[model samples]
Target: MTNTQIVIAELPSDSLTPAHFKQTTADMPVAGDGQVLLKVILMSIDAANRSWMKGATYRAAVNAGDAMPTYAICEVVESNSDRLAVGDIAASEATWSNFVVADAHKCEKLPKVPQLSNLMSVYGIAGKTAYHGLISVGQPVAGETVLVSAAAGSVGGYVGQIAKALGCRVVGIAGGAEKCKWVTEELGFDACIDYRAPGMSKALRAACPDGVDVYFDNVGGTVLEAALFAMNEKGRIVCCGAVSQYDTETPTGPRNLPGLVVVKRLRMEGFIVMDWTQNDAKALRALQTWVDAGQIKVTEDIVDGLENAPQALIGLLAGENKGKRMVRVAADPS
Candidate 1:
């Protein structure tokens, strides 16, 4: 009868909070010609969601009075195109609503998995991002030391594991001691440094005595500066998300920019997961094999209900989540 939606009530000028979002109801959307009606099942909660509000990077800016944009896993309930049929599962660019209309050509038809959430986690954006960013851009070699920031978070955790599977010594930089312990003991990283602790440079030096051959940076500010200093000559730096500066009013950059980059001859490259669309199938196959072999562990932090999406993003930006965070909008079609 009606569709529940979460829209940006007001754009945040500083740190984001739940107050910035509002819940409302709208008439159910209908499938049009060459489009499909989708019942949203799972919505991804990412740090980029916060960054999108500030301004456009790879996509348009999220302005006030607009439905929050997200990549969602949905089930087609009504189809107006030959590309999809009723009960088909799809992944598409959708809003924070229980139901939506998406172009049939743009929606990706997904296979039915035992757990649909896997389509949002390991087999989805998190795993693919880590795979593409590391393999394509980082170009890590065997026996090298791979360092990743925000190691306990979604993408960073997988980056370290994938590097380890490739016979590289993996080290992580997380926020607290507990997260650092999890990164080392559970995720199979050789070492994990607590960036919040004092003497971070010394601790990083101690952890990476051989120097870092590759750095997968997620949180940009000081952690990036620290990793820059520890980088080996000709090391590769994969610039992923900048979680540290996403939700702030005044964001700072890593002061050791071109100077350290030029001196070390480090190959630093930034990328979005969409950049490797041609190799998505290849990456997914490799990820599935690694999952089957137990080389990469999938961790998901899911919150129930669409109304909780705002708090989920806020918590994620505050470094409270341990893995890929997502919101369950509706039950999977059984």
Candidate 2:
């Protein structure tokens, strides 16, 4: 009967930072027709969550005072729909709560990973976001040089690995030396540039000496401008999520966008991961197979308790999280 949830309310103007989630409890909802009750396991702490907390952007503005928009992996505790049953593991949009009542249609049965605690990580929304953008937009060919910004983050990491698997040379651009080292040494990027370094444009040029063919952009401000100058003719740029400017009070618009797309005859497209909903199943299957075969790695930074969800979410925007950030709401013994 206990239901613990993380809620964000309007606080005093100046004190209302991203670290403002409050924990409260209420009576848990029972399963209804076409619904299933989920014992929340893992919830994503994403840069996107920070935007949602602010309540202005198109994606972040889920109706005022509604549960936050988050994807979580849960175990079915009760089911009124035949599609799911007790003990089935699934991924659903449960936000930041210990228990959730979700529509059966929105839940996807998870592939059981005996040794893994968060299969929903690489096989979840973050993985699918990378798969869809890289495959659909990047369309990388063998021997091409591909570039990725926010290279050490969730979707960016996947994009680099997938591109490398497809035979392209991958170059990653991250903000720090440690991240740059991981991108090159661990993720197998052919080169990794520290964007925070002096003369970053020169560093980027040196990394992609042969010219970039596919650019997967996660941090859009100055890095995007630099990418424009470095791309080869007919290059493709897949604009995923822009974490760099997500926290500013006023939105920071792109500066060299038009010229960048024009002179180089490049094709740049921006897309939301939800737009690829039709390909969700295929993407999940591919990611799962890759994980099983050791072809890809799923990195996660998890924080315990729903109470820490707000801080974890804030950490994501500030680039404090190394991989897919998550909040573990309840311990699922099953």
Candidate 3:
């Protein structure tokens, strides 16, 4: 059997584009001991994929000549382990490819549910990341003012709604008018400021009159710097992602960090969602309740074809995707 895959083309440098990847064909790997062969159904394009190319951050590097790193939903074609069965739908950290040979230890069967696609969009990595960062790290309380950067994106969108559920006044900073409208009118954010607008600092100041108590940062650059200036006493900064500086040679950082942390007694923390895996079941149950009752919403920007995976990732890094970036490789029989 043949498999189509994308692999790192050369040593990575700053400002990655689709050209950094090269498409190739290879013989399919047979399922070996304690392994499963998965037919790729769909995959996610995430900011972490960009970091994987430039050495390692919180994990090992993706060596050149290896498959491009990605998180994907897969269907079990064959299995050599007792934990998984053939035909089970599972999620795994796989390659940007048509098929993958993964350790059965690495794949987990997805819960059978109505609206499986919707579940994947909202309750998968994006949703889980938001929940873990907000509840576990930020520890937001009622009546506090919460601010989120990248407010229209996957994790940010979920963070806004979840914060509101806890009775916090939510303000968001997105890129444009449309996203600001979506966050405020549709997602129930108290107010969402467009970071692209002139006088963004003034806008943020006006939107957050009482100062920001909890800040969820996804696209950390100058936006974070602005948030730092507006932080309240004992505020919390949850460093979820830094998409804005992902491909930069020298990533810019917050300049006002010193005074804010010292004067405000702020607790700023960064986390990887995978570290909190033991608590996922509880988070998922709560997320399910919110999603079922229309308290949370989901959005996806899907691109079709395995061949277009590189381009999809490019769009994700460029902030072209309106929500979670997804690539549909094959039809889901379920």
Candidate 4:
């Protein structure tokens, strides 16, 4: 069998489109020594995927003619090492392909869940990111006002919910009225401001009457600037992904940078989820407990078929997805 793959046909100078990617077939890969062949089950479609194309951030740059890279949940159909065996489910850094050969040592074996898609959502990068970025970086205390941007998207939604469970008053900033409503009503945030509406700064200040003690910023354009103006003294800013700037040719920085941060004594920090690898077990346990107790509600936006991965990412960047967005490549083994 041949492996179907999506490669970067051309790097986007501005906005990304389906024309930037090309689908092609290649010979099925063989598992070499200490490697395993994986059948991709789910591929995470994140804003980071677009940022990687601009240049390297935490990882290597995605050049033209290279298969688009992704974080994937896969099944080990062939193994050459003791780290994983055939039929084991694993999570790995994979490319946009039907089959991949990865070093067994790099693949993480995952526990079985009723819905394998959960492995790509709550139990995966999205939930872990929210848990670590909010609790560790944001360091919000009970009764304090916590504000999060992109509240309707993957990590931001979880950030708001996790803060609510911690007894902190939560507010969200999203693009539209519907999304803002979902953030407050469904995700349990105390209030949500539609950033697309007029007088965003005023609305944010009104929602966060106590002033924002912790600002979990996911989109880092105007929303971040607004949050900065509303921060209280000694507040913390968790710099997650910058979704607003990812899909454009020109990216703008938050206007009120070190000024607001310095005046408020705000602690601003940026992190990749991998930075807190040592705390994965603790984070996972907390997330699982919250999920079991119904304290954290999980939402997933899944697109079927590997060919639609490009559109999935484009839509995600356009604020079309409501929660954790992923592309389904294949069905779970029955």
Sort by lDDT, top down from the best: 1, 4, 3, 2
lDDT of 3 by residue, 1-334 (tens): 7999989887567887767889999899788999999999888888888877777877789877888877888889999999899988889888988999999998888866654455557788888999999999999999999999988887888999999988999999888898799879888999999988899999999999999999999988899999998999899999999999887879997987887799999998999889899999998998989988888877777889988988887777776666777889898856
Give the 10-residue window scoring lowest on summed lDDT in candidate 2: 10-19
The regions of model 3 sitting more than 4 angstroms off are none
lDDT by residue (tens digit), candidate 4, 1-334: 9999999999999999999999999999999999999999999999999999999888899999999999999999999999999999999999999999999999999987888888777888999999999989989889999999889898988898889899999999898998988888899888999989999999988898889899998899888888888999999999998988998888898876878888889899999899998998999999889989999999999999999999999899988899999999999877
RMSD, each candidate, Å? 0.9, 2.5, 1.4, 1.0
1-334, model 2: which lDDT tens digit per residue?
Answer: 7888777655323323554556778689888999999998888777776556556676547543565667888899999999998889888888688889999998988866762345646766678888999999889999999999988887888888888878899999987899998888887889999888899989888888899999999988888888888999999999887777667655565687787678889998888888899998898878878778777887777889887787776667767776777888877654
**Of models 1 and 4, which has the larger lDDT?**
1
Model 1 bad stretches (over 4 Å): none
Model 1 TM-score (2 dp): 0.98
Determine the backbone clash count of candidate 2: 0
- Best-fitting candidate, scored by lDDT: 1
Model 3 TM-score is 0.96
The whole-model C-alpha lDDT of candidate 2 against the native structure comes to 0.80
Scanning candidate 4 in windows of ten residues, the lowest lDDT window is 253-262
* TM of each candidate vs. truth: 0.98, 0.91, 0.96, 0.98
Global Cα lDDT for candidate 4? 0.92
